[model samples]
Target: MEKLLVVEDDIGIQKQLKWTLDDYDVVFAGDKSSAISSLRRFTPKVVTLDLGLPPDAENASEGLATLQEILSLDPSCKVIVITGNEDNLNALEAIKLGAHDFYQKPINDEELTVIINRAFFVSSIETENAKREALECEDTPIIGTSPKIMRVKSMIDKVAPTELTTLLLGESGTGKDLIAREIHQKSRRNTKPFVAINCASIPENLLESELFGYEKGAFTGAQKTTPGKIECANGGTLFLDEIGDMPYPLQAKILRFLQDKVVERVGGRTQIPVDIKIVCATNQNLREMVLEKTFREDLFYRISEIVIDIPPLRERNEDVLILSRMLLNQCADMLSKKFTGFSDEAMAALMAHSWPGNIRELQNKIRSAAVMSDTKLISVMDLGLDDTHDELDFSLKVTREKAEKEAVSKALAYCDGNVSNTAKYLGITRPTLYHAS
Candidate 1:
């Protein structure tokens, strides 16, 4: 049962209320101080304040102050003020001071009960709505139901629990960094820091000092000792983004650190030991770079202990609409706008366009459309996409071949690369399925 606080000075009225409000777990107080004490102790969601408390029974000053304090303590609390007959002015003042509602005395049990029930209902609705909003905001790190993305999630689940050096290989704007962070979040070191640094963004001259700490007076600007990214990420996960762009000279030191969990600071003699998990990401082909002598083969082998390949958004065709809707809703909430959905033309444009920039490009388009759209649904023109150029080819033979290929591919993924199971699922012979694939 929900708790209710009743503030009334008269003993006779209190007894009558206890009988009338037998449905609730009610607590009674006769003065402002007692009422506040009960409110703090019980933390009741609903309260009844008599606008004529002990010291100031003839006036509404004490009750009004109690009402303000109650509202201040819990802004979501429902405060129903009780006033004497012909006290409309004081009742209005109580309402202005943030009371939920007011009931004039001689108290009518039936009418007041209705008001109390309604306030409880409203409070419950608001509480549920707040919960739903929180859930929607923190849904998941990776969002998609496509087979390829599902495979990626499965890989992450398998690798996150161990202390494996993970390597994320993907195209530019394909969310390699997001995958890296997800791995760290699911790892044992989640409680510690998850430090990230972009190798390509930092210049060669400062990269060494940034990765390894410098002792005080080691260099002209190195007046005080400072820890590098690897040292700062001790007992945590260190994310090296764009590792393919790392300077060739520094590759030997990184390899040594990986082989032996220790780092020697620049111009320092001591080698500090560290316990950390390294997660590296790169858009370039490290194997090709190694063959060309641009990357160290031993370092590449050390980092790629566990490899996860992130597919481009265009490749995950089924996820385009899902990602677009989610991104649009997020943008709308941030911009404080009401957007229902996308127009038919806008959705077609989204699916048909080749997203060279992948998820990043899709997010930009949706955000732009949400800002420019005046109506509930965003149109193709608002997205600034040329639907004419993105029109699908409607040839019967070509469409049939494309559908058959997609069905086979999805079946293969769903069956975990089992040829017989995929053939059975597609209702085709094994040899036929093999030829189609």
Candidate 2:
């Protein structure tokens, strides 16, 4: 049985509450001072606080002070405020001051029971999540030592504690999703759900309903009522990946939801309020798209209150080698292989190659090499880089730059110096190709 501190000045009401909540190790308090004492002694996860206590029995001053004290002691505590029938204003004020929920003075045993049970269930979930976070700290998936990565780590530390909407800008496979999860895990909302949706992956027709949910029989296939990702992530995070690819029409609805913190299900008239931290990721150049009128500029600004630009592996300097080794070790353990490390030639090849696909590409290459390696050390041949390494310059910078330059030069010749055609053939932006040239 979990401890529950009930703070009520009325003896009759206190007795009724204790009897009703007999399942819990219920402790009673008559005033603000006694409530604080009971809170320190029992450290209850849930507290049913009355709005009128002792010397100020006719007013809500004492109860409000107690609520503040309880929250200051343990922010996670779910304090349910008990108020008189005419004290609706006071109850609302208590909610603003961090009371989890409020009950009217003439309490129905069944109704109060349901609310307390919900608080207990929510408290249990939060406790489990806190433990899981601690375990995650013991072994993290993020592996890097580069200055760029270090800066990202520092930024995560600073930004995660706040409730700002964050935008992760990076090339595909550069671990944007991983960083989003890291932010969620480090936030106060970690104990709640972390719902992720790739705006680019779902069809435009279904994306709206997927986000805002739908009423029963809202559509032909709507079998039952469903709460969408936004509602499901009510107290946690909603990660919108590839937000640039989100359909232009749906962007307005999303913007509306973000602005109001409320959403109405498809075919539903009721607006359901939700509380969540929004984190969005995109690979596209949003500012350029805004200028081209392909994306909503206002929505872009709304989601990008805090932008974190994650450089590609090519720009990450030596993080490639560091990530490669870590991935190799992870693969070895999973596959039950005896791989110690990579060979000198393998390391050279890894350093030389331009990882255009970034972390995802590197992971795939390492997994393949780990499985193919015959000796304890993984070699360049095992990684399928033997033939390519010979063509690489390995002089000024990575061989990928050399490859890019050669491809661009040939494309330019083939296109007869036409920038557009050259860029098209090389599958790069004109600005990118011009910079390369």
Candidate 3:
């Protein structure tokens, strides 16, 4: 049973509440100091605070102070303020001061019970979501446990220590930049600079000078000589984002630099020697571009010494809830809101929607929902997503059976097909596991 703290001064009322809210392990406190002490010791998720306490029973001064202190100690604690029957103003004030809800002196047992249960439910959801977030590996840059993501991580671990020119292929917003940085961090040149340049974002005429620096008199705006991204990334990693968009003319120069490990400034004959690891990312199909004569075939081969393909968000179904919970927590902290988690409808909408924009789209939806939502739980409407999709099946029995089957299969695979170990891992009996399988 969950713990509940009752901060009533009257002995008769305290006994009555203890008997009424017998569903919880009730802790009693009559004054402000003892209330705070009990709060610290028991750490109850729900607290019933009475405004009529000693020293300031006439007004709501003492009780209001206690409410602020309780919230200060544990901001997530649901404080249900107990106000007088006629104390409408103090009740509103308590709510404004961050009390979860206000209750009248003549508290109906059933009504109070419902409120307490709701608070407990929200608290449990938040706690479990937080635990799920904590389960992610801190050392990894990527955040997913799906088979596709696990394979990507394993490939990264293997290739990060090598000097191969890696090419990452994926759709936009698939976190290609993150993978580049992870590879750089895990490489021998981690202590050196890691420079990035987007081929598509920069202008065509200036892209060459951006990759290979220009001399002081190279152009009208070139008043001073500057090192290009490649030179700056000496003994480090150079991340060429959207490499497929790099101009065909500039590809020859990049290939020359890669082959010779030397750079020549624009309009300068000096050969600048630089040792750098190259990591390129592109959302376009480079092979098709090469066949169409848009991207140079030789340059493609030079850059793609090793290729890593990132799976889109739509294909990573198992990671949707994990990423959503993590992103929601981030948005809540950034917006300073006390959001617990998504509602069942919102979760169904998240699973049903095809994330064309990938992780970036998911992030935007979560942040927008956090800003627009008025309650602790985010709804499908708050996410601005259609929940009535044909793909969504609201059958509880089917959903449970599917989830159980997947869990058992994965557990069995993890345990090397050992039925006893799989059952132990799933916290189910051997017979139950066999039936589920």
Candidate 4:
């Protein structure tokens, strides 16, 4: 249920109001202490607050105090102040102090319901916008000049000209965002802002304001009017990252925006139209999110208007060496080091190693090696792969035996065959020495 808290000192009015909003999970607070207790305890996203309380019902002082406390405790809480119908100025002051909006006394059940429902609706939209941004931020720049990398680039060059809402599917750290930006940069919208937001990182409560903006006094703490990311990126591309994590309700709103090219601000009455190219990226199976009711089928169709699935690092082995060199150069330049190259053994290790972490892992390892290596060229030891040399350094069992025999023979030659001393010095028993000979 959508949680809501109604704080008023009048017992009859409180009980009657609670019954009216039976659709919501309602919590009532008769006094300031109880109200704050409920606030911190539940952290309700939307609050219905009376501006007149026990200590100062004739004035708004007590109610204003409660508003300030709510904002201080949770700056994002949407507190709708309840004031006497004649107290317009007090309501405006409360707005400045961060009240979401105000509802006058002698409440009209229908109008109050509209305000509360708007809060819940707007709060839901904000959540989905944040998750969309999270999906976007996880991408990176695909750095390489290999034939395979070049082929991927070729596809990007070709497809970027269209108005398709490209969906880039790849593992984390594979530079999906980089490719997304590249497509946006190459497209007709190159000059416009390439606004990117991660969907998963932002909380659902504030995500709406971040995307659709809100009217001044839309709720307590919505002090001044502000435009969301969507308005900020009017003519540019709005890249929604991790689109799958977007809450279901928001998916519907986004689909609405996609269809009508218009958005309504949180607690807003009129629709705000926006024009921009939309590009989304995600690693999750959105098809499954839709199946489980977590993702919207309509939005999946809206964003996946075009899909570009980039191959993972292991699948594109041909680009490994090329990507490594480029990434190493980036490290060298960033670290201000002149790394000559990798040692022969180091090169072999780099090629042989199974890089499960993809380009990002290799980049970090090489960057570290470049900073720590003593020689101009980094060695296998520098990359922490010296154990890999074991097989390559050994030829056969005879080689091991001959090497041991030569060592014992040399010691004997030096000591003129002092058997007891030689055995003791070599830290070996006589039986072992006899077997070696």
Candidate 5:
């Protein structure tokens, strides 16, 4: 059963609430001290706090202090402040201090139950979105050097030094997030936090709180004050991936923050100043979305200050075999396979196929091939590329160059592009690999 806490100072009302709320696993406290104590012990998702407590029953000072303390302890707790009919001003102040909702004197059991249920529902949604974001942030770095990808690297180098809002445009699985991380790593605030949020993964209702955070008692279940992504990324970079999927209602708030560099948490009257560099990425065309009235024009122009277009793997033909060799070696080591290299037909197959999922798809295929291959060399059939035709020549110089390039590429990839380790792996000096490339 869902847990609920009732913080009523009145003996009669406390008993009445306990009777009406029998469906919940209810805990009770008659004063501010006991209420806070119960809050810590039970950690209930919902709390009904009475703004009139002992020693200040006629005033809201003690009750308000308890509310603040509860929120300080657990920002995610939902707090419903119960107040007298004449204490409307105090109730409003409680809300401003982060109380989720307030009920007047002589609370109707049915109405209050409805509000509590809604609070639980909203909290559940926010919690799920938080989990999704956690999963999305566990991503690897970008790995490629096609001329198209080289151009993107050049663009990142050029833009990383600036405070200009950057927008990364690419298809899904094309490493937009990795590029975002690269930008954050290269920027002046590299030492600070690099907070990233996937706009598409979070629910629309919860996105606002997740972005801007919430004050204690901000909503039904908010028990404490917690900083949001924007606040967490203060003095650093805020990467909003899948920016095109952000809800239209939220566009105005984002645009406002971009303009003012300030954020006001939910149920908060004070504006917190935040100094953050904004980086956004999206697979969809925001310009087209803007034309279609789906995306905001001002927000689009603001975020796309220096847009970097990342070309997909299918378009970067030269990068295929190089990346494949790198991924092949990586998979071989990870899977404990003694695969020496890809066969001639395998190379042709790697070059021939159009990778719809880009580098991500390539990595998966190579990993699968490495595990499935029985021979020392990965065959075309092992790579699931039997239909592809062999286009490579069988000349001595050409064969030698291909072998050298593949070995060097694999070594460099495994060593995370370290020159010394790559040279050591190939049993040669840095200059030799440098000259070959």
Candidate 6:
């Protein structure tokens, strides 16, 4: 169990905090001496230090001393100082003394809980990242020595620093969205929000409202005013996934909005100006769509100022093995399962197979293997792939799975009153069921 050390001078408040942090194994202390002793005993990852302790219950002198000592002992510990409503001075002092944060007294239990929970969540992420680094010498989203993936990574390193409108083209599951996120995280707007919307997912009627927001009286369901992802991500990055699916009419409006950094909400006459970078991704062939008059050439030019084409997984030579190992670890973490890795046969099969569905198919197969593998190591059979099957077998297998049951029932009914077997006549299942109730 995780430990929480609560140091408060008042016995009543100490008991209250002890019960408040009941989810954790909480330790309580009354004064500086008791607080130090508890800290030494618990070595807690999280500690709540009240600003007023004994001998200094009306002041922060002794409380500051306790904070310093806890830091000197365990610098990694998250020390959250409990402060008075108007005690900003001591809070600042505590912050300068390395306190993670200060919570005002007479706190809303929910707000305090959110703060504590977020602190712990961040702490856990950092701890996991550290462990990952220790196990592997490096960390990067794009992994491989393949020329295609390598070029994409090199482009990200260069383009990520700029505020350019980038359009990523690839097949589905080719990591287009991941590349967009990499651009956001590595860009000058790294600290800002990275908003993503799927153009294909939202209906054309609602896509306008989703991109430009709506006023209270915009539509029948518009109960209140709301900002869309584009406006919400102002001063950040807005990623439009499946840009090819964007309707033809809406494309004109989006083009105007991109040309001028302003948008008019649905059902409202006012124009709101916003500043944001755009990153668009699609699994469709935009050039072909342009030739077919489905996609707008003007809008295409606007988004594809800097285009990056990502290759499908089948073309990336050694990336299959690298991606598999990385995917294996991620699957293990999410499922909370201990999967050492895939079998040698599985790795070879994955490497040789043509990933027509690309990275997304690989991801699904890994997830299936992780959940269904009979042992710690997964095999090619677990992937449910038929690499060696001919076209005839493939067609036969699909037909049997889909239509066999229906055909069998029809045959049995037509052969009514026959006391012997049916599949012995049909030859579908092993040890066929005998006929006649």
Candidate topping lDDT: 3
Per-residue lDDT tens digits for candidate 1, residues 237-311, read: 999999999999999999999999999999999989999999999999999999999999999999999999999
Candidate 4, residues 353-422, lDDT tens digits: the string is 7677776777778888887888788887888854453333333345556777898998788778987777
Question: Model 6 RMSD to the real structure?
Answer: 27.4
Cα deviation of 168, candidate 5, in Å: 0.2
Q: Give the poorly placed runs of model 4, Cα more than 4 Å off.
A: 1-142, 145-148, 385-437
Pairwise TM-score winner, candidates 2 and 3: 3
Order candidates by lDDT, high to low.
Answer: 3, 1, 2, 5, 6, 4
| Candidate 3: worst-modelled 10 consecutive residues by lDDT | 389-398
Per-model TM-score versus the true fold = 0.62, 0.58, 0.61, 0.55, 0.57, 0.57
What's the distance in Å from true for residue 13, model 4? 99
lDDT of each: 0.89, 0.88, 0.90, 0.80, 0.86, 0.83
- Model 3, range 1-437, lDDT digits (tens) per residue? 46799998989888788878866668999999999999999999999999888889888999999999999999999999988898999999999999999889787888888888788778877876775565663687588877898788888999999999999999999999999999999999999999999999999998888888999999998999988888999999999999999888888889999999999988788999999999999999999999999999999999999999999999998789889988999887898889889998899889999999999999999999999999999999999998786566745347667877888889999999999999999876898788789
CA lDDT of 29 in candidate 1? 95
| 229-341: candidate 6 lDDT, tens digit per residue | 88999988999999999999999999999999899999888999998889999989899999999999999999998999999998895678778888999989998888878
Top candidate, metric TM-score? 1
How far residue 22's Cα lies from its native spot in candidate 3, in Å, is: 45
Of 3 and 5, the candidate ahead on TM-score is 3
Model 5, runs deviating above 4 Å: 1-142, 389-437
